[model samples]
Target: MSDPVRLGDVLAGMATPGGGGIPAQPGAGGTTCNRCGARADWHRTIRDKWILIELGEWPVGAVPPGKRWRVAGEGTAVNLGRAQPSDTCRICHFDVCPSQPAPVGSPALLAQWQKNAWG
Candidate 1:
Protein backbone atom coordinates (compact mmCIF):
# COMPACT_ATOMS: atom_id res chain seq x y z
CA MET A 1 0.00 0.00 0.00
CA SER A 2 1.06 3.57 -0.55
CA ASP A 3 2.43 5.31 2.51
CA PRO A 4 0.39 8.04 4.11
CA VAL A 5 1.09 11.58 2.96
CA ARG A 6 2.97 13.93 5.26
CA LEU A 7 1.26 17.03 6.57
CA GLY A 8 3.95 19.28 5.17
CA ASP A 9 3.51 17.67 1.80
CA VAL A 10 -0.23 18.09 1.95
CA LEU A 11 0.08 21.73 2.99
CA ALA A 12 2.70 22.40 0.36
CA GLY A 13 0.55 20.72 -2.24
CA MET A 14 -2.40 22.87 -1.34
CA ALA A 15 -0.28 26.00 -1.29
CA THR A 16 0.95 25.39 -4.83
CA PRO A 17 -1.21 23.06 -6.81
CA GLY A 18 0.49 21.36 -9.77
CA GLY A 19 3.61 23.40 -9.08
CA GLY A 20 2.44 25.92 -11.64
CA GLY A 21 2.91 29.27 -9.96
CA ILE A 22 4.42 30.92 -6.96
CA PRO A 23 3.09 29.36 -3.82
CA ALA A 24 1.14 31.52 -1.42
CA GLN A 25 3.14 30.34 1.51
CA PRO A 26 2.17 32.04 4.69
CA GLY A 27 4.50 34.87 5.66
CA ALA A 28 7.45 33.94 7.83
CA GLY A 29 6.35 36.22 10.62
CA GLY A 30 5.28 35.13 14.04
CA THR A 31 2.90 37.91 14.97
CA THR A 32 1.50 38.60 18.40
CA CYS A 33 -1.10 40.96 19.79
CA ASN A 34 0.49 44.03 21.24
CA ARG A 35 -2.25 44.50 23.81
CA CYS A 36 -2.63 40.93 25.08
CA GLY A 37 0.44 39.08 23.80
CA ALA A 38 -1.63 36.48 22.02
CA ARG A 39 -0.17 34.74 18.98
CA ALA A 40 -1.58 35.83 15.60
CA ASP A 41 -2.36 33.56 12.64
CA TRP A 42 -4.45 35.71 10.38
CA HIS A 43 -2.91 38.13 7.94
CA ARG A 44 -4.05 40.51 5.21
CA THR A 45 -1.40 41.32 2.68
CA ILE A 46 -0.92 43.05 -0.68
CA ARG A 47 -0.43 39.76 -2.52
CA ASP A 48 -3.82 38.51 -1.39
CA LYS A 49 -5.49 41.70 -2.58
CA TRP A 50 -3.85 41.50 -5.97
CA ILE A 51 -4.99 37.91 -6.45
CA LEU A 52 -8.57 39.05 -5.92
CA ILE A 53 -8.10 41.75 -8.52
CA GLU A 54 -6.36 39.46 -11.01
CA LEU A 55 -9.16 36.94 -10.74
CA GLY A 56 -11.73 39.73 -11.17
CA GLU A 57 -13.12 38.90 -7.79
CA TRP A 58 -12.74 42.51 -6.69
CA PRO A 59 -13.79 45.31 -8.98
CA VAL A 60 -11.29 48.02 -9.58
CA GLY A 61 -11.93 51.76 -9.04
CA ALA A 62 -15.51 51.22 -7.92
CA VAL A 63 -17.62 50.21 -4.95
CA PRO A 64 -18.47 46.55 -5.12
CA PRO A 65 -22.14 45.93 -5.75
CA GLY A 66 -22.64 43.99 -2.54
CA LYS A 67 -21.58 44.02 1.10
CA ARG A 68 -18.88 41.44 0.53
CA TRP A 69 -15.77 43.42 1.48
CA ARG A 70 -17.41 45.69 4.00
CA VAL A 71 -15.67 45.80 7.36
CA ALA A 72 -16.48 48.09 10.25
CA GLY A 73 -13.66 50.54 9.57
CA GLU A 74 -13.31 49.94 5.84
CA GLY A 75 -15.97 51.12 3.44
CA THR A 76 -17.58 49.06 0.68
CA ALA A 77 -15.00 49.96 -1.89
CA VAL A 78 -12.82 47.36 -3.63
CA ASN A 79 -9.45 49.01 -3.58
CA LEU A 80 -6.81 46.36 -4.17
CA GLY A 81 -3.99 48.86 -4.41
CA ARG A 82 -4.44 50.00 -0.83
CA ALA A 83 -3.87 46.60 0.68
CA GLN A 84 -1.48 46.51 3.65
CA PRO A 85 -0.03 43.96 5.98
CA SER A 86 -2.32 43.43 8.95
CA ASP A 87 -2.25 40.66 11.51
CA THR A 88 -4.93 39.31 13.80
CA CYS A 89 -4.53 37.31 16.94
CA ARG A 90 -5.79 33.75 16.78
CA ILE A 91 -6.91 33.67 20.38
CA CYS A 92 -8.43 37.12 20.84
CA HIS A 93 -9.16 38.07 17.23
CA PHE A 94 -7.63 41.44 17.91
CA ASP A 95 -6.56 43.52 14.92
CA VAL A 96 -4.10 45.88 16.53
CA CYS A 97 -0.90 43.89 16.86
CA PRO A 98 2.79 44.16 16.05
CA SER A 99 4.61 41.26 14.40
CA GLN A 100 8.17 40.10 14.11
CA PRO A 101 9.49 38.09 11.21
CA ALA A 102 10.13 34.46 12.06
CA PRO A 103 10.61 31.29 10.14
CA VAL A 104 7.37 29.99 8.68
CA GLY A 105 7.70 26.47 10.01
CA SER A 106 9.80 25.35 12.92
CA PRO A 107 11.55 22.01 12.68
CA ALA A 108 9.50 20.53 15.48
CA LEU A 109 6.22 21.84 14.15
CA LEU A 110 6.99 20.55 10.69
CA ALA A 111 7.98 17.18 12.07
CA GLN A 112 4.81 16.93 14.10
CA TRP A 113 2.70 17.91 11.15
CA GLN A 114 4.41 15.32 9.02
CA LYS A 115 3.84 12.61 11.61
CA ASN A 116 0.19 13.53 11.99
CA ALA A 117 -0.40 13.54 8.28
CA TRP A 118 1.39 10.25 7.75
CA GLY A 119 -0.36 8.50 10.59
Candidate 2:
Protein backbone atom coordinates (compact mmCIF):
# COMPACT_ATOMS: atom_id res chain seq x y z
CA MET A 1 0.00 0.00 0.00
CA SER A 2 0.93 3.64 -0.28
CA ASP A 3 2.13 5.82 2.60
CA PRO A 4 -0.26 7.70 4.82
CA VAL A 5 -1.04 11.05 3.21
CA ARG A 6 -0.19 14.26 4.99
CA LEU A 7 -3.42 15.97 5.93
CA GLY A 8 -1.80 19.40 5.96
CA ASP A 9 -0.34 18.99 2.49
CA VAL A 10 -3.57 17.63 1.07
CA LEU A 11 -5.58 20.49 2.52
CA ALA A 12 -3.15 22.98 1.06
CA GLY A 13 -3.51 21.49 -2.42
CA MET A 14 -7.31 21.53 -2.52
CA ALA A 15 -7.54 24.97 -0.91
CA THR A 16 -8.60 27.61 -3.47
CA PRO A 17 -9.92 30.58 -1.46
CA GLY A 18 -12.67 31.46 -3.97
CA GLY A 19 -12.88 28.52 -6.36
CA GLY A 20 -14.48 26.07 -3.92
CA GLY A 21 -11.66 25.62 -1.41
CA ILE A 22 -12.37 28.90 0.32
CA PRO A 23 -13.94 32.25 -0.67
CA ALA A 24 -13.56 35.67 0.81
CA GLN A 25 -16.45 35.83 3.22
CA PRO A 26 -17.09 38.21 6.08
CA GLY A 27 -15.35 37.56 9.44
CA ALA A 28 -12.69 35.54 7.64
CA GLY A 29 -10.16 38.16 6.58
CA GLY A 30 -6.42 37.81 7.16
CA THR A 31 -6.80 34.05 7.12
CA THR A 32 -5.27 32.33 4.08
CA CYS A 33 -5.47 28.83 2.71
CA ASN A 34 -3.14 26.67 4.77
CA ARG A 35 -2.39 24.60 1.68
CA CYS A 36 -1.95 27.19 -1.08
CA GLY A 37 -1.60 30.20 1.20
CA ALA A 38 -4.24 31.96 -0.89
CA ARG A 39 -7.01 34.16 0.48
CA ALA A 40 -9.96 32.01 -0.54
CA ASP A 41 -12.88 30.13 0.95
CA TRP A 42 -12.26 26.43 1.65
CA HIS A 43 -14.05 23.32 2.85
CA ARG A 44 -13.03 20.77 5.56
CA THR A 45 -13.61 17.19 6.56
CA ILE A 46 -12.23 14.67 9.13
CA ARG A 47 -12.50 11.13 7.92
CA ASP A 48 -11.08 8.29 9.98
CA LYS A 49 -8.74 10.65 11.83
CA TRP A 50 -7.44 12.11 8.56
CA ILE A 51 -8.85 15.63 8.30
CA LEU A 52 -9.56 17.27 4.96
CA ILE A 53 -9.38 21.03 5.45
CA GLU A 54 -9.64 24.40 3.65
CA LEU A 55 -10.10 28.12 4.50
CA GLY A 56 -10.46 31.83 3.47
CA GLU A 57 -10.73 35.38 4.83
CA TRP A 58 -12.51 38.72 4.22
CA PRO A 59 -13.46 42.11 5.61
CA VAL A 60 -14.96 42.59 9.06
CA GLY A 61 -18.56 41.82 9.91
CA ALA A 62 -19.12 40.40 6.43
CA VAL A 63 -19.25 36.73 7.42
CA PRO A 64 -20.64 34.94 10.42
CA PRO A 65 -18.65 34.37 13.61
CA GLY A 66 -17.55 30.73 13.08
CA LYS A 67 -19.74 29.36 10.33
CA ARG A 68 -16.89 28.92 7.86
CA TRP A 69 -17.04 25.73 5.77
CA ARG A 70 -18.42 22.22 5.76
CA VAL A 71 -16.98 18.70 6.28
CA ALA A 72 -17.63 15.98 3.75
CA GLY A 73 -17.95 12.17 4.06
CA GLU A 74 -19.84 10.32 6.78
CA GLY A 75 -19.02 9.47 10.42
CA THR A 76 -20.07 11.84 13.20
CA ALA A 77 -20.29 15.34 11.87
CA VAL A 78 -18.99 17.72 14.49
CA ASN A 79 -19.40 21.45 14.09
CA LEU A 80 -16.71 24.01 14.76
CA GLY A 81 -16.72 24.62 18.49
CA ARG A 82 -16.39 27.90 20.39
CA ALA A 83 -13.74 30.44 19.47
CA GLN A 84 -10.62 30.17 21.62
CA PRO A 85 -7.83 32.65 20.98
CA SER A 86 -4.50 31.78 22.44
CA ASP A 87 -1.09 33.41 22.17
CA THR A 88 0.31 30.83 19.77
CA CYS A 89 -1.24 29.30 16.65
CA ARG A 90 -2.74 25.83 16.51
CA ILE A 91 0.70 24.32 15.97
CA CYS A 92 1.25 25.34 19.55
CA HIS A 93 -2.18 24.46 20.86
CA PHE A 94 -1.23 20.93 21.91
CA ASP A 95 2.44 21.74 22.38
CA VAL A 96 2.35 25.16 24.02
CA CYS A 97 -1.18 25.75 25.25
CA PRO A 98 -0.57 29.49 25.45
CA SER A 99 0.94 30.65 28.72
CA GLN A 100 -0.77 34.05 28.54
CA PRO A 101 -4.32 34.84 27.51
CA ALA A 102 -5.15 36.26 24.10
CA PRO A 103 -5.22 40.03 23.71
CA VAL A 104 -8.12 42.00 22.24
CA GLY A 105 -9.33 41.32 18.69
CA SER A 106 -7.61 37.96 18.99
CA PRO A 107 -10.30 35.46 19.81
CA ALA A 108 -11.79 35.94 16.36
CA LEU A 109 -8.46 35.89 14.61
CA LEU A 110 -7.29 32.90 16.60
CA ALA A 111 -10.40 31.04 15.67
CA GLN A 112 -9.76 31.89 12.05
CA TRP A 113 -6.20 30.67 12.23
CA GLN A 114 -7.24 27.48 13.92
CA LYS A 115 -9.82 26.99 11.17
CA ASN A 116 -6.89 26.76 8.80
CA ALA A 117 -4.48 24.86 11.06
CA TRP A 118 -2.98 21.54 9.91
CA GLY A 119 -0.23 20.87 12.42
Candidate 3:
Protein backbone atom coordinates (compact mmCIF):
# COMPACT_ATOMS: atom_id res chain seq x y z
CA MET A 1 0.00 0.00 0.00
CA SER A 2 1.08 3.62 -0.53
CA ASP A 3 2.09 5.87 2.34
CA PRO A 4 -0.42 8.01 4.17
CA VAL A 5 -0.97 11.70 3.43
CA ARG A 6 0.76 13.99 5.85
CA LEU A 7 -2.05 16.51 6.10
CA GLY A 8 -0.08 18.72 8.43
CA ASP A 9 2.66 19.10 5.86
CA VAL A 10 0.19 19.62 3.08
CA LEU A 11 -1.75 22.26 4.94
CA ALA A 12 1.04 23.99 6.84
CA GLY A 13 1.02 27.19 4.79
CA MET A 14 -2.60 27.98 5.55
CA ALA A 15 -2.15 27.33 9.25
CA THR A 16 -4.25 29.92 11.09
CA PRO A 17 -1.58 32.09 12.62
CA GLY A 18 0.32 32.25 9.36
CA GLY A 19 2.97 29.94 10.90
CA GLY A 20 4.51 31.22 14.10
CA GLY A 21 5.88 29.71 17.32
CA ILE A 22 8.27 26.77 17.64
CA PRO A 23 5.50 24.53 16.39
CA ALA A 24 2.89 27.19 15.54
CA GLN A 25 0.79 25.94 18.48
CA PRO A 26 1.15 25.26 22.17
CA GLY A 27 0.87 21.94 24.04
CA ALA A 28 4.08 20.66 22.58
CA GLY A 29 4.13 16.87 22.58
CA GLY A 30 6.50 13.94 22.28
CA THR A 31 3.97 11.77 20.55
CA THR A 32 4.55 10.72 16.96
CA CYS A 33 2.25 9.42 14.30
CA ASN A 34 2.75 5.65 14.30
CA ARG A 35 1.62 5.41 10.72
CA CYS A 36 3.85 8.16 9.31
CA GLY A 37 6.35 8.82 12.10
CA ALA A 38 5.38 12.50 12.18
CA ARG A 39 5.16 14.50 15.40
CA ALA A 40 1.58 15.15 16.57
CA ASP A 41 0.02 16.59 19.70
CA TRP A 42 -2.92 15.33 21.73
CA HIS A 43 -6.00 16.50 23.58
CA ARG A 44 -8.10 14.63 26.13
CA THR A 45 -11.58 14.85 24.70
CA ILE A 46 -14.73 15.41 26.72
CA ARG A 47 -16.24 12.19 25.35
CA ASP A 48 -13.27 10.04 24.46
CA LYS A 49 -9.58 9.13 24.80
CA TRP A 50 -6.57 11.27 23.95
CA ILE A 51 -6.69 12.26 20.30
CA LEU A 52 -3.83 13.26 18.03
CA ILE A 53 -4.09 16.84 16.74
CA GLU A 54 -1.91 18.67 14.29
CA LEU A 55 0.74 20.94 15.75
CA GLY A 56 -0.42 23.99 13.84
CA GLU A 57 -2.77 26.79 14.67
CA TRP A 58 -5.92 26.38 12.68
CA PRO A 59 -8.26 29.37 12.43
CA VAL A 60 -11.36 29.53 14.57
CA GLY A 61 -13.59 29.53 11.54
CA ALA A 62 -11.67 26.87 9.66
CA VAL A 63 -14.18 24.23 10.58
CA PRO A 64 -17.49 24.02 12.33
CA PRO A 65 -17.48 26.03 15.54
CA GLY A 66 -18.67 23.05 17.56
CA LYS A 67 -15.69 20.96 16.48
CA ARG A 68 -12.99 23.41 17.49
CA TRP A 69 -10.24 22.81 20.06
CA ARG A 70 -8.46 25.47 22.03
CA VAL A 71 -5.21 25.17 23.92
CA ALA A 72 -5.91 25.60 27.54
CA GLY A 73 -3.28 26.62 30.06
CA GLU A 74 -0.32 24.37 30.94
CA GLY A 75 -0.01 22.48 27.73
CA THR A 76 -3.49 21.14 27.48
CA ALA A 77 -5.66 20.96 24.36
CA VAL A 78 -9.25 21.33 25.43
CA ASN A 79 -12.18 20.35 23.29
CA LEU A 80 -14.50 23.32 23.10
CA GLY A 81 -17.93 21.85 22.50
CA ARG A 82 -18.48 25.22 20.80
CA ALA A 83 -15.98 27.91 19.93
CA GLN A 84 -15.71 31.32 21.47
CA PRO A 85 -15.18 34.32 19.21
CA SER A 86 -11.40 34.35 19.66
CA ASP A 87 -10.56 30.66 19.39
CA THR A 88 -8.42 28.51 17.18
CA CYS A 89 -8.15 24.76 16.74
CA ARG A 90 -5.67 22.03 16.07
CA ILE A 91 -6.83 19.81 13.27
CA CYS A 92 -6.83 16.10 13.94
CA HIS A 93 -3.98 14.60 11.94
CA PHE A 94 -6.29 11.80 10.97
CA ASP A 95 -8.40 14.23 8.96
CA VAL A 96 -6.16 13.65 5.98
CA CYS A 97 -3.80 10.88 6.98
CA PRO A 98 -3.83 8.94 3.73
CA SER A 99 -3.51 5.53 5.26
CA GLN A 100 -5.15 6.13 8.60
CA PRO A 101 -7.80 3.56 9.29
CA ALA A 102 -9.98 6.25 10.77
CA PRO A 103 -13.01 4.76 12.48
CA VAL A 104 -16.44 5.40 11.03
CA GLY A 105 -17.61 8.90 11.95
CA SER A 106 -14.51 9.10 14.08
CA PRO A 107 -12.42 12.11 13.16
CA ALA A 108 -14.94 14.89 13.50
CA LEU A 109 -13.50 17.58 11.25
CA LEU A 110 -12.23 15.48 8.37
CA ALA A 111 -15.41 15.64 6.40
CA GLN A 112 -15.71 19.37 6.80
CA TRP A 113 -12.10 19.88 5.85
CA GLN A 114 -12.56 17.78 2.76
CA LYS A 115 -15.75 19.52 1.79
CA ASN A 116 -14.65 23.07 2.50
CA ALA A 117 -10.89 23.52 2.60
CA TRP A 118 -9.25 20.67 0.84
CA GLY A 119 -9.68 18.28 -2.04
Candidate 4:
Protein backbone atom coordinates (compact mmCIF):
# COMPACT_ATOMS: atom_id res chain seq x y z
CA MET A 1 0.00 0.00 0.00
CA SER A 2 1.15 3.52 -0.75
CA ASP A 3 1.28 6.22 1.93
CA PRO A 4 -1.10 9.13 1.57
CA VAL A 5 0.54 12.44 0.69
CA ARG A 6 0.10 15.11 3.31
CA LEU A 7 -0.10 18.84 2.76
CA GLY A 8 3.36 19.49 4.10
CA ASP A 9 4.81 16.78 1.94
CA VAL A 10 3.05 18.20 -1.07
CA LEU A 11 4.38 21.65 -0.35
CA ALA A 12 7.90 20.37 0.16
CA GLY A 13 7.84 18.39 -3.03
CA MET A 14 6.87 21.47 -4.98
CA ALA A 15 10.25 23.07 -4.35
CA THR A 16 13.33 21.11 -5.40
CA PRO A 17 16.62 23.00 -5.51
CA GLY A 18 18.01 23.47 -9.04
CA GLY A 19 14.74 22.16 -10.37
CA GLY A 20 12.51 24.20 -12.70
CA GLY A 21 12.42 27.15 -10.30
CA ILE A 22 13.97 30.39 -11.45
CA PRO A 23 17.70 30.70 -10.89
CA ALA A 24 19.05 33.35 -8.56
CA GLN A 25 20.37 36.25 -10.57
CA PRO A 26 23.81 37.74 -10.07
CA GLY A 27 24.08 40.73 -7.72
CA ALA A 28 20.57 40.09 -6.45
CA GLY A 29 21.61 37.73 -3.66
CA GLY A 30 22.63 40.54 -1.32
CA THR A 31 20.90 43.87 -0.84
CA THR A 32 19.19 46.19 1.59
CA CYS A 33 15.48 46.40 2.14
CA ASN A 34 14.26 49.74 0.85
CA ARG A 35 11.51 50.05 3.43
CA CYS A 36 13.81 49.93 6.44
CA GLY A 37 17.29 49.54 4.90
CA ALA A 38 18.22 46.35 6.77
CA ARG A 39 20.81 43.99 5.32
CA ALA A 40 19.34 40.87 3.72
CA ASP A 41 20.03 38.05 1.32
CA TRP A 42 17.40 37.90 -1.38
CA HIS A 43 16.27 34.76 -3.14
CA ARG A 44 13.61 33.99 -5.69
CA THR A 45 10.79 31.84 -4.38
CA ILE A 46 9.26 28.99 -6.28
CA ARG A 47 6.25 31.18 -6.91
CA ASP A 48 8.46 33.50 -8.96
CA LYS A 49 8.59 36.27 -6.39
CA TRP A 50 11.43 37.78 -4.42
CA ILE A 51 11.87 37.09 -0.70
CA LEU A 52 14.24 38.69 1.79
CA ILE A 53 16.02 36.00 3.76
CA GLU A 54 18.01 37.30 6.68
CA LEU A 55 21.80 37.12 6.47
CA GLY A 56 22.15 34.66 9.36
CA GLU A 57 20.69 31.48 10.71
CA TRP A 58 19.14 31.09 14.12
CA PRO A 59 18.24 28.26 16.45
CA VAL A 60 15.13 26.39 15.39
CA GLY A 61 13.40 27.36 18.62
CA ALA A 62 14.14 31.03 18.14
CA VAL A 63 11.25 31.28 15.71
CA PRO A 64 8.09 29.32 15.21
CA PRO A 65 8.61 25.96 13.56
CA GLY A 66 6.45 26.80 10.56
CA LYS A 67 8.24 30.09 9.96
CA ARG A 68 11.70 28.62 9.59
CA TRP A 69 13.40 28.66 6.19
CA ARG A 70 16.59 27.44 4.55
CA VAL A 71 18.42 28.31 1.36
CA ALA A 72 18.20 25.49 -1.14
CA GLY A 73 21.12 24.25 -3.19
CA GLU A 74 20.36 26.72 -5.97
CA GLY A 75 19.82 29.74 -3.74
CA THR A 76 16.08 29.32 -3.54
CA ALA A 77 14.42 30.04 -0.22
CA VAL A 78 12.57 27.04 1.13
CA ASN A 79 10.88 25.98 4.34
CA LEU A 80 12.90 24.23 7.02
CA GLY A 81 10.94 21.04 7.08
CA ARG A 82 10.41 18.86 10.15
CA ALA A 83 13.05 20.43 12.29
CA GLN A 84 15.23 18.00 14.17
CA PRO A 85 17.05 18.50 17.42
CA SER A 86 19.41 21.47 17.36
CA ASP A 87 18.59 22.51 13.80
CA THR A 88 19.15 26.05 12.60
CA CYS A 89 17.07 27.92 10.08
CA ARG A 90 17.36 31.21 8.25
CA ILE A 91 14.70 33.81 8.76
CA CYS A 92 12.74 36.14 6.53
CA HIS A 93 13.59 39.81 6.85
CA PHE A 94 9.93 40.80 7.05
CA ASP A 95 9.67 39.27 10.50
CA VAL A 96 12.21 41.75 11.76
CA CYS A 97 11.45 44.69 9.51
CA PRO A 98 11.52 47.72 11.76
CA SER A 99 9.14 49.64 9.54
CA GLN A 100 6.37 47.15 10.11
CA PRO A 101 4.80 46.50 13.44
CA ALA A 102 5.41 43.12 15.01
CA PRO A 103 2.59 40.65 14.96
CA VAL A 104 0.28 41.10 17.91
CA GLY A 105 0.03 38.39 20.56
CA SER A 106 2.94 36.39 19.18
CA PRO A 107 5.65 36.80 21.77
CA ALA A 108 8.16 34.80 19.75
CA LEU A 109 7.99 37.10 16.77
CA LEU A 110 7.84 40.18 18.94
CA ALA A 111 10.83 39.05 20.96
CA GLN A 112 12.80 38.30 17.83
CA TRP A 113 12.24 41.83 16.59
CA GLN A 114 12.97 43.48 19.89
CA LYS A 115 16.12 41.49 20.48
CA ASN A 116 17.92 41.26 17.13
CA ALA A 117 16.15 43.26 14.51
CA TRP A 118 17.82 45.91 12.37
CA GLY A 119 16.40 48.94 10.67
RMSD for each of the candidates = 17.5, 15.6, 15.1, 8.8
Q: Clashing residue pairs in candidate 3, if any? A: 5-98
- Candidate 1 per-residue lDDT over residues 42-96, each given as its tens digit: 3332233211111112222222122123221321123233342232101112211
Ranking of all candidate structures by their TM-score, best first: 4, 3, 1, 2
- Shift of residue 40 alpha carbon in model 4, Å: 0.3
The TM-scores, one per candidate, come to: 0.21, 0.18, 0.49, 0.64
Best by lDDT: 4
Task: Tell me how far the alpha carbon of residue 75 in candidate 3 is from the true structure, in angstroms, after superposition.
Answer: 3.2
Model 4: lDDT equals: 0.70
Task: Name the runs in model 1 displaced over 4 angstroms.
Answer: 17-61, 65-119
Better of 1 and 2 by lDDT: 2
Which stretches of candidate 2 lie above 4 Å from their native place?
A: 1-105
Candidate with best TM-score: 4
C-alpha lDDT (0 to 100) for residue 32 of candidate 3: 71
Write model 3 residue lDDT over 1-119, tens digit each, in one string.
59886888756733443243323332446577666655668654443245677667766665554556666665455766565657567666666454554324434455533432332
Residue-level error in angstroms, candidate 1, position 98: 42
lDDT of 1: 0.30
